[model samples]
Target: MNNIENIRPLISVIMPAYNAENYIEDAINSVLSQSYEEWELIIIDDCSSDKTLKIAEKLSNNDSRLKLIKNSKNIGVSETRNKAINLALGEWIAFLDSDDLWENAKLEKQIAHANKVGASFVFTGSSYINKEGKPFKGVFEVPESVDFNKLKRQNVIPCSSVLVRKECFETIRMERDNMHEDYAAWLRILKSGILAFGVNEPLLVYRLSVSSKSGNKFKTIGMNYRVFRSIEMNPVSSVYFAGVNLVNSLKKYNKILFKNKKIKRLRLTNPL
Candidate 1:
């Protein structure tokens, strides 16, 4: 029998919360409802002025598996996640954002898929939900696998959908808060020839809100440029990749708009 079949490994879930009072409870409860129970959720509140810490405290008090850590000052998401990761004890590390949710079987399915395919890092496809929790028209599916170069074009890995071996962080820690830190880390690991596997199902529920930094695609252009530079790619190369990133981003948004328009037309033609 494979070693995976014989072992029930513990998964450490990292959640960095900052002024997430509106959605933190549902995020915590999603982990609480996971089919796979061998996990510990570490919620690190990045010194929010809101009730994020208080809400996490209340939930943590009820379950030993829930651990709440408070920061003395407000830090960015990358550092906040690094703090939780350092305190994590599990062999595997999974990231769940304060405002996103997982399907009940997300962990169970992703873990199994990773073990069966011998992938150290795994991410899942996600379906979109608005601030009020209403579903978007379609799911975002990821390719079965992607390497370092493939990911450089566009980032398909959603932070909330990541489940990776903890040891992968021995040489990789999220840095450069100005850019996508998670993307930087993944690129570094994949640069060392590690291939990431994707579970092409909507195992994650991503909340779309204007308040999020990524909500405004045009605003992230400079941030994406910094991502290539952080990886030490030359100025000319970085510019090219940044342009590629912008084009791909536009393509993704166009798809979303097309779907929405199609839905409106269908309603108009087939209304009861």
Candidate 2:
């Protein structure tokens, strides 16, 4: 055993898995490969009928640090993640989706940055990886430090790339019906006067699959409308956010249509 291992602070990684057999291993491996060695992987299986639960159980059995929790009934991602967070024993909490992955030095780098900057919460840039496992070149850029004013304009933080102090959960509660739970939680935290800092490094790979919940435009638009309405504000700001959300939804629809056309052309040529 190494001497440094004994002094390392415990980092609890909360992962909510649901029918993610194909990508779960990669997700687990990403955490296992982290340069920061003292961490626990808390995987909550949301009653997946697929091999996801079995695989998670196997991994937990192999590693003492990997803790597996099974839900008796199928709950949504928000509930599953909240349960995992409640069960975590670490001083710091990090979220990783079963279909996404982190770079090897992600935890170490982020922890160092947080400690140096004295930030309670930290998020990093991430590259988008398509279903075929090809990573896109562009990275999502967010403000280095967020305030309520900045967050109201846009939600640039990605949940899978976030690392926050465990105490943050005491103030921000996850909404079960909110499709973008991270954004909602961040807004709540910001409203409470806590500023979240961002790391510019692309330390995570956010997987984008055709079947992803966010891929549904109509559902996302509906959810955004709900989010705008949920915020405690005057009628004027509410209308402003609603209009901003509508334009954002239309932009996404246009991008999706263009991508679909390109995909159709490729299919015609390759016949795959």
TM-score of 1: 0.92
lDDT of 1 at 55: 93
Stretches > 4 Å off in candidate 1: 1-3, 211-218, 262-272
**Tens digits of per-residue lDDT for model 2, 163-235:** 9989989856677555566677878888888888988887988876444344454555556555656666666
Which candidate should be chosen as best, given lDDT against the real structure? 1
Q: Pick the candidate with the highest TM-score.
A: 1
Report the alpha-carbon TM-score of model 2 versus the true structure: 0.84
Residue pairs that clash (backbone atoms under 3 angstroms), model 2: none
lDDT of 1 by residue, 1-272 (tens): 87767677999999999999999999999999999999999999998999998999999999999998988988888999999989999999999989899999999998899888988999999887777787777777899999999999988888899999999998789996777788888888899899999999999988764343343454466677787898899988888887787787566655655766633211100000
Error of 1 at 55 (Å): 1.0
Report residue 139 deviation for candidate 2 (angstroms): 1.8
